[model samples]
Target: MSEKEEKHVIPYINRELSWVDFNYRVLEESFRKENPIMERMRFLGITASNLDEFFMVRVAGVEDQVDSHYFMRDLSGYTPAELLLTLSQKIHSFIEKQYSCFTRSVLPALKKSGIRFLKADELNESQKKYISEYFDKILFPVLTPLAVDRSRPFPLLANRSLNIAVRLKGEDESYFAVVQVPGILTRFLNIPSEGGNDYILLENVIIYKLGELFELNEIRSACTFRITRSSDLDIDEDSDDLLIEVQKFLKKRKRGKPVRLELSRGHDYETELFLKEMLEIEDHQIYEIPGPLDLTFCSSFASMPKYEQFCYRPLQPVYPPSDFADCDDIFKAIRERDRMVHHPYESFETVIDFVRTAAEDENVLAIKQTLYRVSGHSPIVAALIRAAENGKQVTVLVELKARFDEENNIMWAKKLEEAGCHVIYGLVGLKTHCKILLVVRRDEDGIRRYVHMATGNYNDSTAKVYTDIGIFTCREPYGG
Candidate 1:
């Protein structure tokens, strides 16, 4: 490469490594003492959630390239295989730091704050008795132990699902089996204790009563493991129907190629070898965690009641915000001036009211919106449905390829269609990510159009956490 060419070689961090670094910044919050303990725990959970997607999409894509023998380097100058190798090393080290923060820092802080997790061996006699009864009544019936033998083969575990790989011993030979920790149940079980908010991990409870699950054989050892699979949808843009194509891919996503495996630390060699072989994963893909398999569980635990002192003071969205404070009518507010609503600080309710009012308004002739992602039981979708039901011309572009939100989007699309709304599944080769809403109405003067444009989704649930800005405008140029 000549000097001129060398200058053109832009020096940039590998995107995969850069993403790991980004997640590390989130993990750094858990290490900070200044932040509230539960808030710090939430940040840790956020990092875990972020890494899960990184592995599923980014890491999985690289593996596909390596499998196809694509040796071309990225802008950062690392080939597919090289990038994967470097990413594995970077992620492994990052994982070590993550567990260190969780076990050494977060757990101790949580204990100080009246939250404590007891191990199986640390349980008192009464607690053990309670656990036994709970297992028999609540767990046993729901749990199905899948045997792993020559005849049976290892089960196809669901992506991100937690399972316990159990080693059992019979009179003549040893056997291996798997019991998936029920996802429907809570990850942490609160138990009766004298001191603090005492709880034990659901997996520990199952591990304690492994013998009951495998009554015919003696239980040797059991360890919890979780797998992150490649979940990126391979959309056939040329397919007959994009909705049906996406639905097909969503089914295939359940059993997509495994990208990362998380196992509990200090497992037997036999169990480790068995898993690696069965999952067809390299050593780099396996992560032996020192603490819990999935820390995302902590995110929900952070919201436990009566622990407000250990969490940040909740910021309530200022209702009837300055933009809409003087005027109750959404249309009048927009007609007066271009109003910008800063979310979380200001309310998302202003935008919701806009659609809702349009639905109810007798003069409103039509409404249009693009939904990329929305909350479960979205109010925006409900308002759109209401608008359509009221005989207003309503057209909604619900992007079905919103990554991890396909199923929810699909469900909302169906509801919108059923409610007599013209629902578009989005463009064939592109995802409609813009957040815009348009309402057409007849004013005292003539026909007019009002629009609400935003930097975020119409998800009211996320409005509390995500800082997004939206503008309400009735400008002639914008309307046209």
Candidate 2:
């Protein structure tokens, strides 16, 4: 290649900024007038939630490098610090546009469709009574108010945990206190509306009853805020016990330093300053979003009865091949030909059935599989357990370090162990993300090896949403 041709070569988009641009496209979906109002709102919410994770893990990682005075450049020719600065500005502008779209367009459309989000003051006497009852019965029981003092010390804020900071004042002195929003409870509280409409947002209800939580004569200020910590996993390849090392890292993740602080719109200067000082965050790290702090609640919009007309019509997944439909013997079907299964479009039940059939077959000698992420109630895991119980040599390579799925994977590992399956925690340095299942069966033509390779998890639940591909084959060389 000539020097001019090399110079003209297109550089890959910066992964961080490319992600943000992808989110902007999602946001644009919400602006389509043809889309159902609720669906649009859902898209907007997804965009918000996507950015939250991007900042928490990706941007936080770059920021860490910048903080350590290490200048690392990517294919885009931007250093970590340079990228952080650029991302901060871009995100602020994007969020401003998102808020405007939500408040001006989606909210009005929702109201027109008989769903209303009422302010505390707008609630009628009956509505107030219902909300108050809910507070006393549910919210009040779960809340633990933590006061900031010389003795108490600043409490550790878990990543993405929603918290309300309150300014309480007595006759002589004033102080601050924090109350975490419980994760177990739903974020949206659907209240009875006069017509067909409904009211929601647990935060709005909590803020309405702030005076009840505190014994201050004058409740000076209360603002809802959430902190996202640096949650990128860093593993040492040289560690002797990789599983133990990952567990240690997971524990440390809970107390990771705050990388991004999200505050409600128009947060008081004093409260902002206090948070910045206490959390040791720079000005660029703070983001002020109008409306709710977390947009994951937008998922609830899908449940809105009247708004069903606005969203995409649900479709049932189909089996990829018709031959497997009649022949229940998956091994026999695979032995005949190679089969490719498209997921979200193709039924994952076929995958589950393959495992179930293998577990029950007396001819099957051994089963080996790699698990990245499995469903909470995984049929695949059940099949593995059953195979182990039947005395089949079952070997499972469970990636214990799959992010956010670590705790669930740990639980599954223990369950598999109890069932007598030999479980491996995966390789030390590299994550075993590849999805592979190998089955050895004693057939009429001697022992044969069958394999299943998929682009997605064997998790049945996520198969309904994420698009993925899977292939089942007994072809020579490749299958073995």
Which candidate's TM-score is highest? 1
TM-score for every candidate vs. truth?
0.96, 0.93
Candidate 2 per-residue lDDT, tens place, 1-480, comes to 999999867668888888888888999988888987777878987887788778768988898889899886778888888898999999999988888888888888878877787878888888999999999999999999888866777799888989998877745666778989898888877787768467767888888898888854467888999998887888786888877877888899899888889999887777888788889999999999888788777767665675677677876898744546676668888988887887887788888888998999999889999999999999999999999999899999999878879879988988999999999987876788998999988887777889999887878999988898888887453334
Error of 2 at 96 (Å): 1.5
Candidate 1 error regions (>4 Å) = 1-9, 170-173, 477-480
In model 1, what lDDT does residue 21 have? 90
TM-score of 1: 0.96
Give the alpha carbon lDDT tens digit for every residue of 294-405 in model 1. Answer: 9999888888777778898999889988878778677887888999999999988888888889999999999999999899989999999998999999999999999999
Model 2 spans with C-alpha error above 4 angstroms? 1-10, 170-173, 304-310, 475-480
The local distance difference test score of each candidate is 0.90, 0.85
Deviation from native of the Cα of residue 225 in model 1, angstroms = 1.0
| Superposed Cα deviation of residue 132, candidate 2 (Å) | 2.1
Residue 282 lDDT, candidate 1, scale 0-100: 94
RMSD of 1: 2.1
Clashing pairs in 1: none
